[model samples]
Target: MTRKRVLCISYQFPPFAGTGVFRVLNFVEHLPDRGWDPVVLSVLPGHYERGTALDDGLCARVNGSARVHRTKCFQGIDAMLSLRGTFRGNATPASAGQGETAGTAPAGKGFWQGVKDAVTLAYRIPDKQVGWLPYALAEGVRICRHEKPELIYASGGPWTSFLIGLALKAHFHLPLVIDFRDPWMNNPYDELNVGFRRRVNRFLERWCLRRADAVIANTEPLRTLLADTAGSGNKCHTITNGYNETEYVGLKARASGTVPLVVTHVGNLYGKRTPDSFLQALTRLIDTGRLGVHEVAVRFIGHVDEARINNLIGSHPVSAMVTCVGVVPKNQALKMLFQSDIALLIQPDTRLQIPAKLFEYIRSQKPILAVCGEGATQELIEAHGLGVVADADDPEGMEGAILDVFRQARSAEGHVKKDYMAFEAGALTTQLAGVFDGVFQSSPQMKNG
Candidate 1:
C-alpha cells in the first residue's frame, strides 16, 4: 500500500519535555502502522522556554522512518539581551540589577515586568510563539515544494502553527487538518486583550476553521465547542490524548508491602490548579487522626511553584509529609507513578478541559484520586471505574476519597484496573488515521489535490 505523506507542523517536539510533545510524538510514531508517512517540522531546541528537563529518550521514540525537519526561530527578548551583553562586554541591565537572575525577571521589577508583559501581550497576536510563524512557514513551504505531501497536520497553541497550516493550504491546495491540543479563542485561561486583539483572534480562528479540511479536538466537548464556534460540525472530530504502553515495558509496579501510603502527582500546575486544596485535605485528615502524618506521603514530581506550595504546606500539620521532587526525567517520573499507592490528579474549575496526565495515571494501574469539578475528568474516572473523584472545592469530600483509597491500599485492593486498550496510543492513532481517511475520501479538494 502507498502510504499518504503528511506534513506535521508541531512547535513542541521531543527533547523538549511537555504535555504537548507526546500527542504529536505518539501520532507520528503510530501513523506509519496505519498507512501514513509523517514528515515532522518542528522548532529547533532552545528557541522556546523550557518548562521541564529535555528527555532524549522521547526523541529516540520517534519512528525511525519519519523524516524530522528542525528549524530556528527569531530569538526572544531575553536572548537578545544576552547577545547584547556578549557584544558590549558588560552585564545586561536585567542581569546587573540586584537580585535579578540571568534568565528570570528581576525581584523588584513588578511594575516594569507588568509593563513589559502588557507590551508583549499587545504585540504578539494569538501567542508569544507567533514570532516563529514566519520561519516555520518558510521552511514548511520549502518542504512542500520538494516533498509534495498530501496533507498538513498542524498541532497548536502557539496557535501560530495552525496559521502555517492555513498558509500551506492556500499555497499548495493540500488537505489541512488543524489539531487543537487545547481550545483556541474559547480557552478559559487566555487573557485576550479586549477590543482589537480579541477581535483579531476571533477572526483568525474563524478563518482557519473555515479553510481547514478537518479539525481534531482532544475531547468531544472541545470538538463540539469548535464546531459550534465555526458553525460547521461536518469536519470536527474527537481524538483524546492517550498513553503509550510500550514506554512502561520492563518497569515493575510498586511492591504491595511498601509502607507509608505514597500519593504522587506528576505534572505541572498553573492557573486554578494548585496544591492548596489537596494540602488542606491532608491537614484535615491529619488533624482528625484519620491519616497519620508519618504514615502518608504526598509527592509532587514536576514543574511546580515551590514557594506557593511551601506556603500552602506551612499552614498544614502534614507539612513534613509533602515532598516536591521537582521535575525529573520522564522515566524517573513514571517510576514514581509506578511505586505510588495512589496517583493524584488535580483538575481546575474548567469543565471543558481534561489533563493528559490522567491517562498516564491509568497506565500506572494505581487508583486515582482526582480533585476535579464536574467534567470530562470526573466522567472518565467514573466511566472506567478508575478511582474516586472529589470536587476540587470540597475539602471534606476530598478527605473522604483519600481515606477510602488509603483503606483500599491497606487491603491491597487499591490498584484499580480498567480496559485501557482504547486509551492506548496505537489504538488512538488508528482512530486518527480513520479520521484522516474519512476527510480525504469525502473532501472534493482533497480528492483533487
Candidate 2:
C-alpha cells in the first residue's frame, strides 16, 4: 500500500482552458483513485492551442492516469498578444472534436515558421513550462530525482508554475504544495497592471510561500488573502473550485435549452469583475419599461472587452439588452451555461472570495445573479439555496438583487432542481482528495527532512 507520489506542476492544463487550470486538471485527473500518483508538468500543444481543454477523452483520461509531461508552449510576444486577445475576442481555446485543422495553428506561416516563431522567445524547453529557467531548473532536477515525490504540486498560468515547484523544493527538501491559481501580491489591480513581471512574481511568491509545506488557497477569500500576505494566516488553506459529476453529465448530454430568456455570463472580465452594476440594473429595467413579461437575453460569454464592451454599452440602460458572445467554447461555455435562465455572477469588489467561475456557477443551477462582495461569494450563494445575491460593490443593493431575481423569473412556471446541476465531478475530485489528505497528513515528517 505504498503510493503517494504527486508532482503536478501546471500551466493551465487540459488543453489549457482559461482560468486556474481546471482545478489542477481535476487534481491530476482524479489523483490515481485515492492512492495518488500524479506526475503532470504541462504546457504543450504548440503555444497552447489557445490555452488547452481539448479532451481526446480528456486526453485519454489524462494519459491513462498521470505521468503526462508536455513542455513546449513558448509564444512570448506578450504570449502572442495574449493569443491575439484570445483569438480576437472569442476566447475559446480549441477542440470541437478537432477539425478545422484540428483547431487553431495555421494562421499563415513561413520563413521556417517565422524562424521557429522567433526562436520561441529563446527556446529552453525544459519540459516546456515556458520562461525556461535553465529549462525549468533542468526539469526540476529531473522530477526530484525521478519522481521520488511525496507531494510537490504547483500551478499557475505564467507565474512560472510557481518557479517549477520552487526548483523542486530547493532541490529535494520535499513535501511542497504551493497552489495559488490567482493572487500574487494580493492582486486587485495596482502596480502597472500588476507587472514588473509581477515584481519578479512577488519575489517568487515569497520564495514559494515561505518555502512551502502547504499553502493551497483557491479562495476562502484567497485563504484570507494568502494568509494576510504570508505573515502566516495559519499558513493558508481552502481547496475550492468544484463541480464535475462526470463533467456535469458530459454537460447535460450536449446541452441546448434552445435559447432566449438566457441572461448568462461566464468568465474573465476584470477590475471589479465588471458587469457595470448589473448593466445599470438592466438599464433601469430596459429604459423604464420594466422588463415586464420578460424576454431578456444578456449573455456576455467571455473576454469580450470591445473597449470594455464599448464601456458596457455606453454606460448601460439595457444597452439594447446586450448579447456579445465573444469568447465561447468550453463546450460552448457549457452549452451556454446549460441553457441559461439567469446565472449572472460578477465579482471583484476586492476578489470577494471564491470565483473559479463560482464552481461553474454552482453547477449552473441556472438562477445565480450574484454581483459580489460580502465574501465567500455570498456564502456560496447562501449555502447553495442558489439564485440571487447582488452588490458588485452595491448599486441599490445591486439593484435590489436583480429585481429580486427578476421577480423569481416572473412568477415561476416550470420544473427545476438546479443545485448547479447537482455537483459530483467525481465528488468534486473527492473533495480534492480531502485537501490532499489534509496536506500530506500535516507535512513536516518530510521526505527531505
The number of the candidate with the highest TM-score is 1
TM-score of 1: 0.87
lDDT digits (tens) for residues 344-371 of candidate 2 = 8777555534767777766655667777
lDDT of each: 0.82, 0.65
Worst 10 residues of 1 by lDDT: 76-85
Tell me the spans in candidate 2 whose CA falls farther than 4 Å from its real position. 13-20, 25-33, 37-134, 144-262, 268-303, 306-341, 344-362, 367-415, 418-449
TM-score of each: 0.87, 0.33
**Total clashing residue pairs per candidate?**
0, 20
> How many residue pairs of model 1 clash at the backbone?
0
